[model samples]
Target: MAITDKFSSKQIFKFLPIVAIIIAGINAYYTVNEGHVGVIKRFGEAKDQQPPGLHFKIPFIETVEMIEVRTRKNAEKMASSTKEQMPVTIEVSVNWTVEKEAALDLFKRYGGLSQFEQRILDPRFRSATKDTIPQFEAEQLIQDRASAIQGIERRLTEEMAGFPVIVDNIQIENIILPAKYISSIEIKQTEKNLAAAEEHKLERQRFKAMQAVNTADAEAQSILKVAEADAQAILLKGRAEAQAIEAKAKALKNNPLIVKLTEAQAWDGKLPATMLGSGTMPIMDLRNSQEKGN
Candidate 1:
């Protein structure tokens, strides 16, 4: 019975190679998904990269590492100082993707995404941000954040020139300033707004005053024109009256009978009941008296 058991164990050992071969075959086939590349390594040495598809490898001796080629986002927060030596906390997010052709090389150099981020991406990002942030003062960084973000992005791109990763975009998520400084800025802004409002009010009052002056000038001019017109009319009326008086005096000199005729027209044809000592007698017209005297 022991001989038979030993023989059976030897037989199982002989089939072990077939089972191993079956397992190797099963592990040889790997599918690289979309937006991913498979980095092939043989005997622990990087060979090349394969595109998205089913791929075969020599199973116990060859290995494949799936590398994502799609864009990915990473965020990091760091503490830095401005040119004015003001401390700030900066949060930045980056969009990045590995270069497909350099996948094997990237894998060989940094092993994987986690290792690459630790060794290259995170450190370079922090370095670039720190290097660029100190170039601007705290106020300038706050006032012109676009310029600060551009500077950091440019520096980071430059730092990643020879690396196998493409930086699609970098955004400065937040820049936290000191609470005291923010309060001071708010106070200053409030004062500035108040001053501007006061200036505007003064300007409005000045404009109203100017309008009033103009209206008064216009009214004065209108009154002066009316007075001048009235005076001219009065002068013309007086001249016309004087002219009539002079003509009437000339008529009276030319014809004295006009006075007797006017007096006859004004009389009531009644004799005075009593005559005063200085009163002149009203003469009565006698049509035939002149003929009688002649």
Candidate 2:
């Protein structure tokens, strides 16, 4: 008489495999990576978030979704124009991340993060860039590049205020302008440069002319001073000689013999053949005396 067992040893061995499979399925777990967050859900709906390592959820009924929590790059293109129907092209990029406290909420509301590009990023960024870029001109975009990027950042921040994302910053990489307008501007710049060169040359010429005039004036003044000095010396000498002659004449007024001797001594015996306005008449005594001295 033997007792019947509920399971045979073979059946238990098969059950052993089932039990191992169940255990293995239950043991399926993951670690949330360093810069990532996990969204845990029940029946494909987000329930909670786990951060940075070792997480477990009900194996069959619960689901976990991993999302990158680090900052992400969204490189984009934008354009604007000067109201004059001018077309422009610009390259833009943004650094962004999910708001930490809102990660779980975002996953829950936005259908588990599959629609980030569509629901959150694309629309919001497009709205921000379009709204802000159209306000600037082509030249303004080139010159105020930093300000343009800042505008995009500010607008994106404002647009995403109700969302669970943060715009770390915006970068405007480059701007392209129309070829015709740029060429015209370059030509105008060349003309401006030529005008500046002409102006500089004229200024130099004017400076040189002024220097020449100043030098000529200085020389003329110096010559006037020298001529005045020479004339003054000649006048002084003439006055001294005239005074000496007058004194001698007064002294000779009392003595006639001394006058004759003075006249003889004054003669160099080179007398003129004719006197002032003389009619070739006899000036015999004066001629005879000068010839005797010679």
Candidate 3:
């Protein structure tokens, strides 16, 4: 019996190291997935970092905590007041990630990701939104929505510098204003449209009036031109008639025989009705008159 006991003890001692090694291997190694990093802690203090994939650590004394380095999103809805002192609701989303270099510092300070978001990120986001939204009027906020969103994002990013996380992006998902303001805006728009329509109508009427005036002016100009031509024609005709009459008078003065010729041409074949005296008549030749006298 003693001999059998001695052999069994020797065999157990030989396998003890292998069992211990197996246990240590199981506890010493860990895996980190893509987009994740591990923080190794020694004696409850953050010592170093491990990148993605398999990593090893001391079995009992060291511990590893995985942190997501990939981008993450958080959405928050907040009530705020605009520059007009109007009440509004804003829904915003923030995309962020753990800064890899700051991972150990973050873990040491906040203990975990959830605690960090709740204690630091959330408050800062709320404060930034509240501070920025009041700078703009409600109408401006709605009209310049994209600019407002960018402003908020910039403010939030600036405020987040105190934290260990890097802000990747931010967005304003929605903005809700009071009902009365919307109704007032609609009324103003309708009035503006009506005014514009009235102006257009007035402009069209003015254009038509101008067209009528231009047409009248053109017609008056044409009538004046025609009247001038007619007057010129009448003057020319009168001058021509007067010239012909003057020419005939001058020709008659130049030759007295022309008058006798004209009278002979005008006379018909007729004798005188009476003779006042027996002297030579005006129609007798001078030679006959001289013989009679002798």
Candidate with the greatest TM-score versus the true structure: 1
> Per lDDT, what order, best first?
1, 3, 2
Best by lDDT: 1
Q: Model 2: what TM-score? A: 0.63
- What local lDDT score does residue 26 receive in model 3, on the 0 to 100 scale? 98
List model 2 lDDT by residue over 119-197, tens digit each. 7886778777777777777666667877777888888888878777777678877777889989987898899999999
* TM-score for all models, in order of appearance: 0.72, 0.63, 0.64
Q: What ranges in model 1 sit over 4 Å off? A: 1-22, 224-294
| Cα-based RMSD of candidate 3 | 8.2
Cα RMSD for candidates in order: 6.7, 8.4, 8.2
Candidates 2 and 3, the one with greater TM-score: 3
Q: Mark the regions of model 3 whose C-alpha exceeds 4 Å error after superposition.
A: 1-20, 208-294
Whole-model lDDT, model 3: 0.88
Q: Which regions of candidate 2 fall more than 4 Å away from where they truly are?
A: 1-26, 78-80, 112-114, 203-294
User: By TM-score, highest first, what's the ranking?
Assistant: 1, 3, 2
Worst 10 residues of 2 by lDDT: 1-10
Task: For residue 221, give model 2's deviation from the true position in Å.
Answer: 9.3
